[model samples]
Target: MVTPVHIRPKDDEIYLDCNATTPVLPQISRAVSHTMEQVFGNPSSSHITGLQARYILDNARRLGCEVIGAERGQLVFTSGATEGIQTAVLSALTAVRKQGQVTAGKYLLYGATEHKAVPQALAHWNELLGTKAELKAIPVDRNGLLDLDFIAQHLPHALMISTMAVNNETGVRQDLATLEKVIRQHAPGVPWMVDCVQMLGKGQLQLAQTSIDYAPFSGHKLYGPKGIGFLYVREHAAFTPLIIGGGQEQGFRSGTENLPGIAAMHTLFELLLDREQQVFKPVATLGAYREQLLAALRTAFPTLELNHAFEYSVPTTLNFSVRGVPSRDIMDVFDAANIRVSSGSACSSKVTRSYVLDAMGLDDWRSQSAIRLSFGPATEQATVDAACARIEEAAQALRHSCLLLSDTNEDFDSELDGVVQLRFDAQCCYLVIDRSAREMAVIDPIPQLADRIEKLVACQHYRVKAVVTTEPQGDDSTAAMLAQLLCASGCDAERDNVGWPLAAQADCSTPVDCDVPTDGCLLVGNRRLYRVGSRQPVYLLSSPIEPTAGARVDFAFVGEQAAPQVLESVLGEHTLVCRKWDDDFAIASQLRELKGEG
Candidate 1:
């Protein structure tokens, strides 16, 4: 029996949502705060400040290098593990594209439940490559575990294989060591990549001990900073840089590094390793909590079904579905009571179910009813008891449905459509623009932002001419932030500034100036050459979908009166505009004017 920490429980704010992001460890917080103040110098700088920072950052890299069992110089500190994955994937694809084989198609072999980012990015690539690589999803059994024999059958024809060391949703260990043995015995040459984002810091990574070519782990997940993570790339394993310039990270990635986050990430790893007994005691406490949790859940909802066979699952994560009750509804109700919990995958807390659940052959009802209750080192027994009780109460509350739950009555109430239901709630902001074949610019994308805009326009009629940041100086509090997000969407982003050179056909830097005076006349062509086009009835969603899908407005429903307001707003501008609403939002739109309207 592993000894647990004597964490004196104070107040009960049981945060069982550690799967999303653990709170920054006190050690990491102190280190990052110190680095922010003392090591403000750039590691790439040559002066004393730079030299000092370089030494500090080098130490950070060395720490990461040592923790993951890589050589001192082999490990590259990335802003986060997401960047690491992007760099690795882009590198792999670039290498494949460079081989000059006309019909050479390198497929991205992935397990069914891999994180959404990996598959989504690859899906975009597959669409571009008429025959890029066929996406072969190795099947998982009824227990949400991968079928090794299934993977064994597919490797002969696959060029690359990517799997997770642990499932983020179910916490099911993938028997990676065993999986590696299978790979060594069967398919030796194919590059095997592991996404250890959910596995790192819990124990040793042993990258050198294993034969995997690349692995990704985020700093935030390891009780480090939110924005930094690292990727382990074995020496001699060639991959392309997603961001090409500045020659940073041994030419694997480019851009000014988030040294602070990286530095703290390194400290988190060091501290975690140094205090494995202290920091990871949550694992044992979680084990005990897990048994209690399962018992209570089984008692309250006797029809509870574990998402996977419990014995093979990791102690930190618990995914189970209750009969009849929607997992989202249960989560929402408990959340209202300040008891935080997540469902299916923490990545999309409101999305209800994960692609992982769907891939596991769960029906929509079964998948939607699933909730993931993960534990951390600090979780207390009483907190677990309260959280479980709250979950049951919430589940019950969700079932008490009344069509008119609100006190307000709708008489002529058709005016609520001026909102955008973001298709994906995880978005930082929404892009509201006319989708035309005209030239465009990215508003303001940081270097970290990948080819998102380009991908959005690649197959479409529209052309992205440039980018702009409404808040360029990051002063009027921010422009680079919104622009940086565009890269994540996969488009080249550039800041729009007043004396900037004109490679762009359109001015992208204009502050959306939501408060500015505007009659919506979208200028297409040039100031003197292009077309001034106006399209009426612009629809807003909480998020944007593919440009090819046309204008679809969607938002979540928050109350009884919410849906009706959506229809009214759409009717106000365009009686025929496509609209969807709920407790999600209050939507509105605008239609182009006809000759008489002026």
Candidate 2:
């Protein structure tokens, strides 16, 4: 029997990004280390050590074949799924080249939501092979299923078709049997490649029973080590080698094999395919776990909506979005609670919107705010319970507090809570909020963002305590218009304030809150603002003033006339400095880092 492993380095941390990659199980790690120590001989060497290494390699190949239900020679060891995809694309395009003359108007088809590697590989090899074939993206419905009618329409002139068994971002699985029948019926003898990276442990694939020409898999997607994977080629499929070095894998692939990674995968395969042991959870159990997690999410967020239907997606993943919260905000809250989740494919995290969701025809809000939570097949009940508890806590925190420090007015909406910086043009305004107290203060109000600010104050039921300006204001200024708007919203301001005096204008003994601006310091709620210099007045804010002492300088708002040296004097180690003329200013992530949330 395979022993269950706890792979988390910290007990408090919960990892829910298994779709991107899984933690290396302890047994797999041990297997790798043991193989490195004991089976150190090169398989190409002509000696007893080489024989032992060869035995291990062959055994690994046998296990992989058994897991995927493929024959021995059909499996080729590869670096990972990307290499496999590249190799497959090269082979198919090479075949197109060998077939007398290239057909004009021939198109290469791929699922719109396929991993970036697939389309990129197809485009790369298609140009190099001089096929001059046009590339087409097969569309998907809102549930992330392929449009079969569109596929049938494009199949006649298609050179090669590629589709994924399961999407990496949304966990939506395609109907492989139906897809195969459609391909065979419309375009007989055409090559088809399936990206199977997300399907290894979550589902079974009988490759020999289908007409799929090539399939690629990664080890890290399962519980095995990275840098090791295998590619399955149909028994009589056209083949071309991408890497040509020393003869390896019967001249199909070159370079020395990743023996340790293969050995680790051998252990994982045994756990996956062993029917008698049943090391991994069954489909039904995993589905139940998903429901339980979904319940927790529903309880916490009343407006939560799933990006893909549960009936269509793999149980290991849940892709969803909250109505008003952005993906980055939720990610930050979860991270603060020691729970890890992802926005979308780890490869495309830098890209704000999910192309997969966009291809599915989801609304802009859902696509922009989507969050993916994925767990491994071997996850236990206790871990799920702990994750649910953390999720609830994070949701509560997000609903009550403003986690971000700065954002553009274009990106910021009225639905957010807590303190926020609404930036427009070169200048910015602040909504200093204490949500629990239902109190608010507006600093440096601008007319451009007046509507959004009024909506926020009205929606959140905040009382406008004071409208303060740190600079001179003209009659046509929108600051007065903003005050009138707030008044119309039934938010009566107690004070309409003028600019604070510089250090030279006041005595050192004056109180911080005095209208005369004594000692160059002003107090608004918990925040303390200090005027730094006489010649060029720059205000430094030591923010989120708490009852505890020793509050650090978190933000600095520079004046137009402020000198660099004056600004430098007020800068702290973690200070986020901003000026009116700055092209852009964002400190949400930096503030999280200061609070140990990032």
Candidate 3:
């Protein structure tokens, strides 16, 4: 479970594994360091600091665009080249798929040694594009170059083609022009894409006139800062964004721009290009060291396999697998000897298989036993010599431990700040408030008529985003409760309170303030339920009054006796106990007369 962290040894140790990830250049380091200390303003503001940071990022975008031979605005900054690779691949595939141009039974034609992000993004396209995503690896020659003939054969089923500019392990360069020519001949309409991360400054990538639709590159690979990269979506090529948010990058990408990182990376890209020819001059100084090391490797381990042919490889990378030697033990022995190298380098820990080797049809056994020694612009001849010496020593000591095994980057336990639950268990209604949360709402409200409306919301752990009276009560108690709650909670409380009491009661438990809103309320106990709003109410209850015999309000029973007319009216439609002694029957008849005519 040990992490094979590419720990750059102290000043005493030699580190030639720059391809895995390069250390920040001193110039870039100073830029990022200084910017971090000084440029801390949000770019959204229109003030001096905001405009300064914006200017820095805007210039960075321009430089990044230029480095890729793209138009001034043809580039976009991203988290890293992994995002670049994903964005370009997914966009092209989606655009083609949506237009229904690549008809049935089509597949994504890509080089075998392309970065794993390529296929991973393709998997997403398969799910989201509503089309079967078939990923077919174009065959490669033994030296790790894509076979043009193989591509010609598969172009029929391919919707798009992707090939890396150079192999990370093999140091092999892909002939972009040759690849384009073949695509034009066979699949002319299919877009050609490339991950140019490893190829940028080593030599020229004449992308201006190629059939390449998209290209991805990382800043760190080209002497820029980490956490920043760019994608070159050709000027006219229709594209879509992968990370969609706050309408930034002309609505292509959205997030507060990492201005400092952007400025540092932008400047570095410009620096890399101006010095591109001279920048890699120091690489050639290691020529003798490479020769001596390769010779030593050939003599000491006669059966060792130089996985990549040195003839057509990048001068910066070396990949070899010693026969029957396990890469892990060798890497460990070198770690102790103050030398750093890789077993199988991958961009993301999630996809750590040696995608480069896997593409070349190398079996897991040999591929796992391979180690990569990479370099950068600052690599020195002596450093190379010291690293070569340490590698020889480590390989010999770990010979017995060379078990031909591969391991992935450690999956450390990352504790994400989990979503805080707005839990509510109200035995009695209690207000909870969390000002930091965005969407918070009430579950249940108290039905008490005498409860403090303000206290219901003021005593919470959250700032209520919205309020809903699930059940409406007729009256202003609902309105009053709402007005106080809204004032206390500082939210726009919506009006859901119709005309009903908070709870069903025997007599209308309480009335609402009609000045604001009428809380839906009802009467209980002895009072009759009435449709009361403006004038006299139409009462519907068990008790009756006497105006003539048993009329109420406008008419009543005088002298503590019922009216004769009302009693006669009641007798006609009597269904109650009207005793003769009580004269209740007569009272009912008289009441019936008031009901109309007896």
Best by TM-score: 2
Order the numbered candidates by TM-score, best leading: 2, 1, 3
lDDT on C-alpha atoms for all candidate structures? 0.58, 0.77, 0.58
Write the residue-wise lDDT of candidate 2 on 1-598 in tens digits: 5455844355688999999888889899999999899998888887999888888788888888889988633888899999999999999888878986565579999999999999999889878777888899999999899999999999999999999999999999999999999999999889999999999988988898889999999999988888999999998899999889998887889898888988888898889877886558999989988999999989777778999998888999999998655687667667777778899999998998899999999877788789999998989888899989987886776566644222132223435445577655345677666666666666677665575577577666677654545565654566655665563233333322243322223222222321223134544456555555433445555656554554466767655555544444556777766554444423444445545676
TM-score of each: 0.62, 0.71, 0.61
In candidate 2, position 108 carries an lDDT of 93
lDDT of 2: 0.77
Please identify model 1 stretches exceeding 4 Å from their true place.
1-12, 100-106, 126-131, 275-277, 349-352, 378-598
Give lDDT: candidate 1, residue 106: 44
Worst 10 residues of 3 by lDDT: 411-420
Query: Tens digits of per-residue lDDT for model 1 on 1-598?
Result: 5456755433655678788877777777888888889888877889998888777767777777777888622677677767777666665655555665442454568889888777776666556644467787778887777888977777776667888888888887788888898777777867777889888755566688778888877877767778787788887776767677998766767777777787687676676557544555655676787888777667556667887776777787888876544564356544565666687676675685677878888765567677887876545577788877865664455344221111133211122113212222212222233443344333323222223333333323344333333222432323344334332233333323311123333423221212122222222232111111111112222223332333322322111122333333332232233222212122232222211232
Q: How many angstroms is residue 260 displaced in model 3 relative to the true structure, after the best TM-score fit?
A: 2.2
Instruction: Return the candidate ranking by lDDT, descending.
Output: 2, 3, 1
Better of 1 and 3 by TM-score: 1
Angstrom error of the Cα, residue 102, model 2: value is 1.4
lDDT of 3 by residue, 536-568 (tens): 111111233222232112111121233343333
